[model samples]
Target: MIKALIIDDEPLARDIIKSYLKDNIDLKVLAECSNGFEGVKAINDLKPDLVFLDIQMPKINGFEMLEMIDEPPHIIFSTAFDNFALKAFEANAADYLLKPYSKERFLEALEKATQKINSNAPIATQKIIKDHQESVEILDRIVVRFGNKIHIIGLETIRYIQAQDDYVDIYTHEGKYLKQITMKYLEAHLPTDKFVRTHRSFIVNIEFIDKIEVYDKESYVLHLKEGQKISVSRSGYSRLKEVLSF
Candidate 1:
């Protein structure tokens, strides 16, 4: 039997989904959760193959809750808001079932999800999460999973960003936290006026910069307020000078 979990805040909505699933004998309803918190725990413990998830809930919303999951199950989003449809698809959701949908619509989504599961197709939820994050806004903060704990780092607190293969080391006053993001993404997303790419491998926060000293006629190095010196590429120096207006 294909195990399924229903996560929604409304009791009526939960009942509706349960009723719809009654006819689909191939998929068994394993659990019903009221909110994202319970949903997370239930998903972990039960290991459901598919989840009927609602977006808005108490404590954490659907996207935030999905971030907490190490390996997310196939998701069929059931939300009232149409605005979330694009983001849901971007997250590689099996289907988006807007609230008040008919049983026929529900069955269509279930069939799609069932096909994907049967094919053993890998869901690219992580990439979808990253793309969804960048689509929202110029981020004031970033959420990162460091070991078992999650860290929310304010963009202003970042001293510099250094590339490390596929990942980047985020340096701050507390220490450095490794984030699995590209320099290209950060360069485009970070506030350009504040954070400047000082080299091919490094981006420095302009507020923390003490001074720029010439290494040669064309090359230079930046001395940060924290007493760390960062190499500046020839082109980087030009970009810095344009921003600093000197």
Candidate 2:
């Protein structure tokens, strides 16, 4: 039997999915989650083979929850919003089921998911996530997972970002969180007026800058409000100058 999980905010939506799956004897409903936080915990503990995921939810969205998982199961996106249909396909989702869909449509998506799971197909979720991040005009917040804990960091709270090999360390007033993301992606997506790429390895929030001083003949350093010093490259200094108008 294929284990499945239904994750949606609306009680009625979850009920509808359960009713539709009653006749599918081969698929078993493992758990039902009302929000992304519960969905993440359920997915981690249950390890479902297929997930009927909803896009918009409390705490985090479907995509953000997917980001928390290292190896996400075959997902059939079910949402009322049509704006994410293309992105869902790009993420190599099994299928995108728009809400208020018929039983026939749900069955079709289930068939696709079952086939992929049975075939043991690889999910290119990371690439799709990266592409999605780049496509975002501006990022208002960042979601990061540390161990079993999930943190939602707002742009205003971010002090700086530091590159760490394949990951980037996001420093906020609360603490530092590591995320599997690129500095290039963050540089492009973060608000330019508020954030400045200060060095090859550092992106600093302008609000957190306490002062700037010369580090050497060719480079400079920034002192943050939290008493942390960040190195600034030549080109980085130029960018800072333009942004700070100094």
Specify the highest-TM-score model's number. Answer: 2
Tens-place lDDT digits, model 2, residues 1-246: 999999999999999999999988999999999988888899999999988888888878888888888878878887787454466465554478877999998888888778888888786555555555655678888999977988889999999999999999999978899999889889988999999999999999999999999989999999998899999999999999999999
In terms of lDDT, model 2 sits at: 0.87
Which pairs of residues collide in model 1?
A: none
Q: In candidate 1, where is summed lDDT lowest over 10 consecutive residues?
A: 82-91
Best by lDDT: 2
Candidate 1 regions with alpha-carbon error over 4 angstroms: 5-25, 28-47, 54-71, 79-94
Once fitted onto the true fold, the runs of candidate 2 whose alpha carbons sit more than 4 angstroms away are 82-85, 88-94
17: Cα error in model 2, Å: 0.8
lDDT tens digits, residue span 1-246, model 1? 789999999999999999988878799998999987788788888999998988888766676667768799888887887454466474555478888999999999999889888899887555655656667556567656566555668888999999999989999998898887789888888988999998989999999999999999878999999999999999999899999999
| Predicted structure 1, TM vs. truth | 0.77
